[model samples]
Target chain A: MNDTLMTDESRLRREHHKGHYDRETVYRILDENPFCHLAFVQQGQPVVIPTMQWRVGDMVYWHGSSKSRIAHGSDSAKVCLTASRIDGLVLARSAFEHTVNFESVVVIGEAQRFEDTAQKTALLESFFDHLFPGRWDALRAMTASELKATAVMGLPLHSASAKIRRGPPNEPEEDRATPVWGGVLPIAMQFGKPLPDEFNQMPEPGYLARLRTKP
Target chain B: MNDTLMTDESRLRREHHKGHYDRETVYRILDENPFCHLAFVQQGQPVVIPTMQWRVGDMVYWHGSSKSRIAHGSDSAKVCLTASRIDGLVLARSAFEHTVNFESVVVIGEAQRFEDTAQKTALLESFFDHLFPGRWDALRAMTASELKATAVMGLPLHSASAKIRRGPPNEPEEDRATPVWGGVLPIAMQFGKPLPDEFNQMPEPGYLARLRTKP
Candidate 1:
């Protein structure tokens, strides 16, 4: 992992030493989160784009419109990306001590735009398949013009770092005497009843079955 | 509701639309999400920070280290924040068409640092009550040094926009003739069993109880 991407901001410091960096830990966190906030500077100002992302080994891929202003110039510009998931809320005794337990990955690198049609198509296929195992095979082939209108960019994960904080809050030895109630108020994501599209003729996909059954 | 915030992004171009400025729809999505990616430019370079956030009325408060490098000029910095939640994964007949249904809020604003002690204390209290109710009174008060060392910033929700995409993929009518299977692979977030802190000596809070029983 690149040490440059790691910075110690006093307020959000790595607590419990669990929020440190390592390539293995970083990759796992990145894989778990499907969407990432891709940030870059445009016209000397900060711009953030929310998009779906897929990881292949040590590289991350994201697609954009051919006319996207930022996407067109990403090949030469510096980029910073952040992906996160709040697993639980750490409700400690003191209001000042309260914090949310989360896992987040940050990647800093220069993006390389993929220009080859075959390579872009392959990457796009993997991006879809990574989220839905067999969905890519169900669509019609991309037309030449359609292919020309889409762009894909790849950024290596070597300069990435993972920061995570889990469990309870950090209470001072002096404040431990307080009689306030304290414990973890875990956060969770739930899928509501599926609303099928007007055009969908069949039931949900099999992969969804596997996901729902997962503990 | 600011009409200027509703600019025409190519993906979410809604022309001559009214009632798109309600705060409930905008704030609900903002308050529901626990984490946000904050992007800013430092020395002509892009930087991203993932931090916990709370929405109170029309303002969002986020706190971090007073000594951190990212917030070096936050008082005068133009920041862009993006918050998102992935609801479900769309499994299309073709891999290229598979997509994820999601809700996102994007804000571009000038961050104003809160140096006043009273305002900072109030913001911190809101942050406390939002994270956990009835607990702020239970904990000890913050020390003068602690309050001084921490930096609190507020960005009004005036300049913001929310975007969402749901349901199944939109395929060409002619593609139905092809023999590819297509459906949605639903995605969801579900709460797991609460893991109490190893050092906890008191009972769990009531807020957590509701979280455990809710859908």
Candidate 2:
């Protein structure tokens, strides 16, 4: 198995017990979360933007409006990509011990922009198709002008690491018998319901309907 | 009465239609999301760390291990604080039109650390109590070492703006009739069943039980 190779940047320095290194763990977090915060330096100040990302093979893809600052500045620049889900709120028996149980992956790499128009066009279609098979075929094709206005970028996932914390509240043995409450409250992200467009006369896609429970 | 003041840094340059200003919308999004991505520059490179935060009046507070790099590096640094929730994945009829419906707030400011031990301890309690009333009182008292080992940082919410996109997919009329499916899928974050610690024997707190349905 090809494991994730940790670099100086990907290594964890604090609470090292929470660090994780393995392709299996990294991909699991990425596949489970569709949103991520992409961080990069701009004019010597750090800026982080939340965006939708898709993973295909060993590469992760993200796209936005051509006019967006991230679309223009992040390409070819060293960046940190982080996708994290708060699993639970760790309510402890001591104030200082309270913490959050979460799963996070941080990847450092250079973002590469798609140079070929056809490559960009095909990848964009794949982005939608990945969510629901045959869904892209039902939508109209992107026009020349439409494709020109979108910027598609990708980064290799070769340098990445996942960090996670999941457990019951950890408190000193002396503090355990305190009269206060202590435990973990689990959190989940779910899909509510799909609202079809008013003009639409099609049955809710089986895939979309299924998300109500699975999403 | 008093709304957040807008500055050049907090203003949106693209998709002006999606930008929202004022206290009502900004606080609504901030209060709902349990965690936020803290962005700061490190040695000229950008880094984004996810952490839990609490909003108290005009200030937002967060805490983590004192040994963490962010604890030391974020202080006095001009940082971009962002809290976002991905509402749903927008499945558009065109590749370029595909977008995720979300609500996000970005605030740019310098992070200031609480140097006073008592102040830090008090805020830490408030952070927990805000999540669950009387949560801090139920827990045992924090020791000196515990308070010293955590860093509490704050940023004012004076200059913040929320960006949101909701409702059905927006597509060109010409493309609407395509055989493909197009609509909005709603995403919701909620609390799951609480997992009590092995030693926990107190009646499950009503607040904790209500979260299973509300969180």
Which candidate achieves the best DockQ against the true structure?
2
Residue range B1-215, candidate 1, lDDT tens digits: 55345543312333123123456666877887657888877655576878767887778778876775445654337787777778776655554455677777777677778999888888888877775677677778887887887889777776677777767776766655555545454555555666666666777677666656644
- Model 2, residue B86: what's the lDDT? 86
DockQ of candidate model 1: 0.47
What digit string (tens of lDDT, one per residue) describes model 2 on residues B1-215?
Answer: 34754677677878989998888888888888758998876665577889877888888888888888768854347787889988887776776677888999887778888979899988987887767877777776777888888889888887788999987888778777776667788887788878888877776787887667663
Off by over 4 Å in 1: A1-21, A73-76, A190-205, A213-215, B1-4, B7-24, B73-76, B177-181, B199-201, B212-215
Candidates in order have lDDT scores of 0.69, 0.79
The global Cα lDDT (0 to 1) of model 2 is 0.79
Give residue A146's lDDT in candidate 2 (0 to 100).
80
Off by over 4 Å in 2: A74-76, A213-215, B74-76, B213-215
Q: Which ten residues in a row have the lowest lDDT in candidate 2 chain A?
A: A69-78
Positional deviation of B124 in candidate 1, in angstroms? 1.1
lDDT of 1 at B55: 83
DockQ (Cα-based) for each candidate: 0.47, 0.71
